[model samples]
Target: MESPKIDIITLVENLAYQQGTKGEHGLSFVVRTSGRQILFDTGQSDLLVQNAKKMNVDLSAIDAVVISHGHYDHTGGLPAFFEINDHAPVWLKSKAFDEKMSKSTGTPRFIGLDPEVAERYRTRFRTVEQVTELAPGLKIVPEIGSYYGFEQPSQSMLIKHGKTLSADLFEDELFMVFEHSEKLVVFAGCAHRGIGNICRSAMSLTGCNQIQLVLGGTHLKGASKGRIAKTVDAFRDLQVEHFGLCHCTGLPAFMEFSRVFEEKVRYAHVASRFEPFD
Candidate 1:
C-alpha cells in the first residue's frame, strides 16, 4: 500500500503571520498520516484547545498523544486534551514524572508534570524507554543519549532525585518520526536533547540519510554565538533541507537559521501547516 499523505499543523506557537490567532510560550503540533492522527505535545495551557476550536480543527480524531518532556509549558494541556482525544494513549519517556524545576538566579519554581493529573490518566499512559513503533510509519523515540555537540541542556533546570538535586538531563525528551516512501520527516518538541543529537538520532532511527524536513522547537533561545555556529554546521553536514523552527528558538538563533537555510527555514506558528511532499 502507498504511504498515506503526512500533514503537520501547528496548533500553538509564539511566532508568525496567522491573523486572529493567539500565541504562547509553548508549542503543539497535530500530525495526520497513515490513516492516523497524532497530537504532539500539548501547549502550555488551553491555548491549543482554544486555537484548534477557532481554526475548526477537530481533536476527536487523535489516535495518540506524544509528550516531548516533563516541563509544564509542554504538558500543561493534558486535561484539555484528555477531554477531546477520547482515550488515546499518552506516549512519553518513562521518567516523565521526575520532579523538575528551574532556578534562574531567583526563586526556583516547580516545572514538572502535575502528579494529580498524571494519576488521573495513569491507565491511558504509555511510557517507553526505547524506540517503539506506534504504527506502520510512525515511531516514538526515547532519549537521544550523549552527544558532544554544542546543543547542551539548560543549566538552570534541575531534577529532584530523592534527597539529591540532579542536573536535568532531560531523559524525558523524545522526538517523533514519520517515514514516507524513502524519506524521513522528524519532529522534535523543545529538543532539549540538542538538534544535532535529534538529527543524528533520527537518521539512526530511520536508517536513512534523506530527511524531508526538521520541524518544531529547537530550544536554542539565548545560546552562545559559538554554539549556534556549530549547530548550523551540524545541520549543513547532515544536509537538512527544511526547518520549521518556532517556540523558544530566539530571534538571534532563528535569524542565523534563516540566513543559513534561507527559504528552507520557515517559522511554524498558529495555523501553520507543513506538507513536505506535494
Candidate 2:
C-alpha cells in the first residue's frame, strides 16, 4: 500500500519563499497528514499566525501543537496560537519551560518561552520526557542517549534555574516523526541537539533506516567548517533521501549540502510547501 501523503506548508522562517509573506528569524510549519493538522513551532512572534492567515491555513483546525525546544524563536508565538486554537494540546519536552539564555552576541539574553504565556496556559501544555505517540502515527521523540563528539552544544547557550546558570545541554530538544507506510518523515524546529543526533535517535527509536524526508532547521549556523563537513558525512551515512533545510541551517552549510546532495536538497523558506511522499 502507498503511504499517506504528508503536506507541509512553511508558515514562518528566516526567508520568504512566496511574495507578500513576511519572514523572520524563526520557524513554523503547518503539517497536514492523515486528516490531521499539526502546528510545528510558533516562530518568535505573531508571524506564524499572520503568515498562516495569508497562506489560508486555518489555525483553529490544528489538531495539536508540537514545540521542538524551549527557545523563544520556536515557542514565542504560543500566546498568539492560543488566542485562535483553544483545544489542541501543546506537546513539548519536560524541561521546555526552564529559563534559557544565549550569550552568542557577547551579552546574555533570555531565549526561552515566555513565562507569562506558559503560566497562563499551563493546563493546555503536555510535557513529555520520553518517546510518546501523540497520535496513531505521529510520535514525539526526545533527544536521548549519546551524541557525536563533533555535534557538541554551543557554549554560549545557558540554562538558568533561578540564580544558578549552567550550560544548555538541550535535553529539552525533541523532534516529530511521521511514520507512513515503512518510511519516516522527520520534522525539527532548530535541531539544537544536533541534526545528526536527532536522526540517529529517530532511527534507533523506530528501528527503521529509511528516512524519506527531513524538514526544518539543522542549527548549523556559524558552525565550524569541520563540523559542517562531519554533519554532511553523517547525513550521507544516514542516507536521508531528501532535505528541506531552513532557518539556522545557514547558507554556507546549505550550500555545502546542495553541493553534495544536489537535487535532493532544498532550502525550505517561508510559504514553501512540501509533499515529501510525492
Candidate 3:
C-alpha cells in the first residue's frame, strides 16, 4: 500500500531566525498524513498558535494532539489550543507528569498543569499507559524508562499559592512512530531518554530496522564529543537519512553531526521543512 504524504509545519524555534527575526522557545509540529491531522507537541508558549496562523494551519480540524512529554515548554499552549478546539482526542502517556517552575533562573517548581487549564480538558483528555497502535501506521511508545545513564527526569511543574516550582522526574516522555511502506518517520520531543533508546524502542515496536527520518530535539546540550560521535555512528548504522535537530540539540553537538552526516543532517530551525522518501 502507498503511504500517505506527510506535511510537517514547524511552529516554534529555540534560536534566532533570519535577520531581525526572533526565536521562540520549545517545539511543535503539525503532521498531516493519510488524511489525518496530528499535532505532535506544543512549544513552551502559544507561539505555536501564532505560527500555525501564520502558516494557515487550522487547529479546529486537527484529529488528535499528542503531548511528547509534560514539560511546560511542550504543553504550555494546551490551554489555548484547547480553546481553539475541544473535539479531538488528546492522547498522552499515563505517566505524562508536568509541573510548574519559577520563571527566574530555573528552579524546581510545582507538579502538573494549572487548575484553570486542567479543568478545560479534564473530561476529554485521554491517557494511554501502555504501548499501543493508535492508527494504521501510527503508534505511541510510552516511557521507555531511561537512557544514557540517566533516568530522563523532567522538571516537576506546578503552581502553589501563586508560586511555581520544578517538580520531579516522573517518567512521562514518549515518541511517535509513523510506518509507511516499511519506512519509519520517528518524532520526538526533547528525547530525554536518549535518541538511540527511542530508535531502538521504535524498531522493537514496528519490527522494522530501518529509520528513514528522525525529526525533533535530541536533548544533547551537555553531551560530550565522544557521546555525540557515538550517536552519529549509530544513526549511520541505522541508515537514517533525514535528521531535523533543534531545541536543546545544542550548538556543539549539532555542528559535529552536520560534519559527520553532511547531506543527511539538517539543522532544524523554525520554518525548517522537509520530506523523506526511499
Candidate 2 stretches with Cα past 4 Å from truth are: 1-3
Candidate 2: residue 146 lDDT (0-100): 60
Models 1 onward score TM values of 0.95, 0.96, 0.85
Between candidates 2 and 3, name the one with more favorable TM-score: 2
Cα lDDT tens digits for candidate 2, 1-278: 56567789999899985767999999999988778898989999988888888899999999999999999999988899999998999999879999999899987889899899998999999988777876667788876546587888889999989888899999898898988777888898888778888878888888888998899999899999999999999888886889999999999999999999999998899988888777
Instruction: State the lDDT at 172 in candidate 2.
Output: 91
| Candidate 3 similarity to native, TM-score | 0.85
What CA RMSD would you report for each candidate?
1.4, 1.3, 3.7
How do the residues 1-278 of candidate 3 rate in per-residue lDDT, one tens digit apiece? 57565667676778646443345768888887778888888786677777777667898999898888776778787878888987888788755544434333455444345546666677767898887666668777785633344424433223333443334344677899888878788988988777888887788788898888899998777777777777777676675867888987899888888998887788777766656662
TM-score comparison, 1 vs 3, better candidate: 1
Q: Residues 14-93, candidate 1: write the lDDT tens digits.
A: 76367667988888999987678888998888888888887788887788889999988889988888887777899998
Q: What's the lDDT of the predicted structure labeled candidate 3?
A: 0.73
Candidate 3 differs from the real structure by a C-alpha RMSD in angstroms, to one decimal, of 3.7
Ranking by lDDT: 2, 1, 3
